[model samples]
Target: MSWHSDDGSGTTADRTVEVWPDDDRLAEELGDALRDAELAERVAAAGRAALAAHRREAAERDDLALELFLLTLVHDSELAGGPVGVRDRSGSTSRTLVFEGDGVGVEVELQDGQVEGQLVPAQAGRVTVRRPDGDVAVVDTDEVGWFHLDARPHGPVRLVCESTRGTCVTEWLSW
Candidate 1:
């Protein structure tokens, strides 16, 4: 009369995560009335708010140290023959990019076709490089407002510096 056969070989069950009780904190907190879409929307909104707040706080700093840190990381690529001279085949060639503006001084070395440098500014947020190819690369300064640029050709190039207050661009440099 039972659902199982009297032979004692019915169906055995074991504790498995997929088939067992799972964490229901989110469900419990949101309640059964809230749909999945609503929960997702709420999470997205919260994330946006947090991102906005962080950006605002960064903008309110005395200087762009945080932005400079990011810039350093991106521009710290290794370039050969330094960033100033033509690419050489021997691999002993290297150059340096010197950025001087608004009482800030920064020196970066170019080797292995990469840029590795730093920022020595009282305050800096962003740094941008416009290569002769018309491609643009922008990097944020770190906590110390330091930055570097990747190794590129000696053609017409532009360097732009930016912060919460404003932006400044270098005229042009010959390779």
Candidate 2:
């Protein structure tokens, strides 16, 4: 016998099958095929939904359109004015960056694989630390706008702060 089946593209294709009236196995095989087809359609629908969700997130990230500014790096000794000359050291030295905007200011200190930072005009908010490879670590700031992250992110990194002043995204930096 010949029948038509949907190929999932709003089009039908002819399928030829042989039916044996006395063979009970044919009936079982047909039932199994129908079940498998239904399962495949469900799986495809799920995959489509996941893809749509991912696209929406990407769009939101792009829509924020936060400005990126360079942060000036300063060493502890420089701030203290102990010595003006450069010195060669074996180990790493502590570094600090101060980012000042119109109404927002952020201070970050990096030492010993730990990040300690404070935000000016202190308000409660969440801070997100993002790596270049899309890895993110988040922390909530206290009422005083203090936050800490015990992670060492290699390569370029950036920060995103969501506070009463709205969202602020920092320029990529390297430690």
Candidate 3:
């Protein structure tokens, strides 16, 4: 269904479209609907671009967010933010992912060997990580823009984020 929400500026003209059931059939219908709605194609394209940009920004920001949160936990909680080295039912070890943000940090610990890290909203996406062995792993962020990479067993590994905006990388540390 097509919906709209105001920007809370006391003006209904300044509205944001909210589409539901983002499925293939819905998408096709939306594309057809856009043909009838005035400037709907531009609106949809702009909205998609904006959402893609936001996803890229989140991925770029995640390394810092993870680092800062991990630092806080390591100092305040006295917990090891490293790979626990034990495999779960999926045959992958759990890892605590700490990323730093501006004045605020986020920590996500998952028992899945790698954090599903970033959600890029672009079909054309890349996640480059410098492996502990000095090899690089470049992966597509998927259609929905989600990407995952296994953190190294030990030694210094760096996660590099690259997208239409630019590129950013994390610091080297033995995990």
| Among all candidates shown, the one with the greatest TM-score | 2
Flag the better candidate by lDDT, 1 or 2.
2
Per-candidate alpha-carbon RMSD to the true structure: 13.0, 12.7, 20.8
TM-score head-to-head 1 vs 2, winner:
2
Which wins on TM-score, candidate 1 or candidate 3?
Answer: 1
Better of 2 and 3 by lDDT: 2
TM-score to true structure, per model: 0.39, 0.53, 0.37
Q: Residue-wise lDDT of candidate 2 within 1-175, one digit each (tens)? A: 9999998999999999877766688888777875897787997899999999999998877765554333333333346665543343745566666766667867887777888888777888888888877856899999988999998688898887777877776777776
- The all-Cα superposition gives candidate 1 an RMSD in Å to the true structure of 13.0
lDDT of 1 by residue, 16-101 (tens): 33232446865565565455787878988999999999989878773654333222222222343345454558756666566565
Please say which candidate is ahead in lDDT: 1 or 3. Answer: 1
Ranking by TM-score: 2, 1, 3
Sorted on lDDT, best first, the list reads: 2, 1, 3
Worst 10 residues of 2 by lDDT: 68-77
For candidate 3, write residues 1-175 as lDDT tens digits: 3445577886564345656555987888877887876678689889999999999999978865554321222221125554446566777655555544333332333443455555323334566667667655677676544676664435566656555544545555445
- Candidate 1 achieves a global lDDT of 0.59
Clashing pairs in 2: none
